[model samples]
Target: MRPDLELVANLIQTDARVLDLGCGDGELLHNLQQHKSVIGYGLDKDAENIGLCLAKGVNVIEQDLDEGLGNFQDDSFDMVIMTETIQSVHNPLLLLQEMLRVGRECVVTFPNFGHWRCRLHLAASGKMPVSAHLPHRWYDTPNIHLCTFNDFEALCAHLNMLILQRRVVNRHHNERSLINLAPNLFGSYGFYHLGRTT
Candidate 1:
C-alpha cells in the first residue's frame, strides 16, 4: 500500500461505511475491508478500474466526478475518501462539499505544489516541475488545479470544514520532524481527515 493509503486506513473506524471517490483499482478499499472490517464502495469513471474492482470482489460504481454526486443521499456513509486525484477535478471545492454532504467525514490526500523542489524548479527553469510525485508534463498532466498545503487549508476554512487531523510527509511518504515547521515548503504530500463544522 502507498504510505498515504496506509495512514488513511488507520483513520477509518472498524465496521464503518466508506465511499471512495476516484478509487482507482479499489486497493485502498480492499485493504480497509480486510483489516478494518469496513464496508467499502468505490466510484471511478474508468471502465478498466471498475472491472478490476469487481474482480477483487469490491462493489464499485461508474461515475464521472465532474458530473457531480447526486445519486448519494446526505450522510449516507461514515467516511468518504479521495486520494491523489483532487488536483484533476474541475471543481474541487464543490466535490469536497458533496463528499461531506454524503459522509460524516472524508479523507483526502494530494501532492503539495508548494514544496521547495517544485518552487525551485519553476523558479530556475521557468517551467513546471516534474518530480517523482508529480511525474507529468504540464500539457499532458491530469492535474488542473494544483495547490499548496496552505491553499487547501484555506479552502476548507472557506467551506466551513473542520480538519480533524493532518499529516505531512515526503515523497517517500516518510514524516520528517522538520515538516511540522514548514509543511508547505518541505512536505511533498498532505493527508487530511476533515468533517463539516457543526
Candidate 2:
C-alpha cells in the first residue's frame, strides 16, 4: 500500500462504514475491510479501476464525483473520503458538501501547491513545478485547481465545516510534526478530517 494510504487507513475508526470517492483500485477500502472488519464502498470514474476493485472483492460504483452522489442518503456512511483527487474536481465545494451530506465525517488529502519546492521551481525555473509528490508536467497534469493548506482551511470554514484533525506528510510520505506552523511552505501534502460545524 502507498504510505499516504496507510496513514489514511490508520485514521479511520474500526467497524465504521466507509465510502471512498475516486478510489482508484480500492486498495484502501480492501485494506479497511480486511483489517478493521469495516464495510466499504468505492466510487471511481475509471472503468479499469472499477474492474480492478471488483477483482479485489471491493464494492465499487463507477461514477463521477462531479455528478454528485444523489443515490446515497444523508449520513449513510461513517466516513466519505477523497484522497489526492480534489484538485481534479470541477467543483470541489459542491463535492465536499455532498460528502458531508452523505456521511458523518469526511477525510480529504491533496498535494500542497504552495510547498516550498514548488515555490522555488516557480521562482527560479519560471515553469510549472513537478516533484515526486506532484509528478506532473503542466500540460499533462490532472490537477486543475491546485490549492495550498491555508486555502483549503479557509474553504472549509466558508463551508461551515469543522476541521477535526489535520496532518501533513513529507515528500517520502512520512508524518510531520510542525505542520501547523507553516503548512503551505513546509508540507508536501495535506490531510484533513472534517465534520459539520452545526
TM-score for each of the candidates: 0.97, 0.94
lDDT of 1 by residue, 60-139 (tens): 99989998889999999999999998999999989999999999999999999999999999999999999988999999
lDDT of 2: 0.91
Lowest summed lDDT window (length 10), candidate 1: 2-11
List per-prediction Cα lDDT, in the order shown.
0.94, 0.91
Query: Tens digits of per-residue lDDT for model 2 on 1-198?
Result: 988888789878899999999999999999999999888899999989998999999999998888888999999999999999999999998999999999999999999999999999999999999988889898998898899998999999999999999888777877666655777898998889999988
Q: For every model in order, what is the number of clashing pairs? A: 0, 0
Question: Which regions in candidate 2 have their CA more than 4 angstroms from the true location?
Answer: 177-180
C-alpha RMSD for every candidate: 0.9, 1.4
* Runs in model 1 lying further than 4 Å from the true structure: none
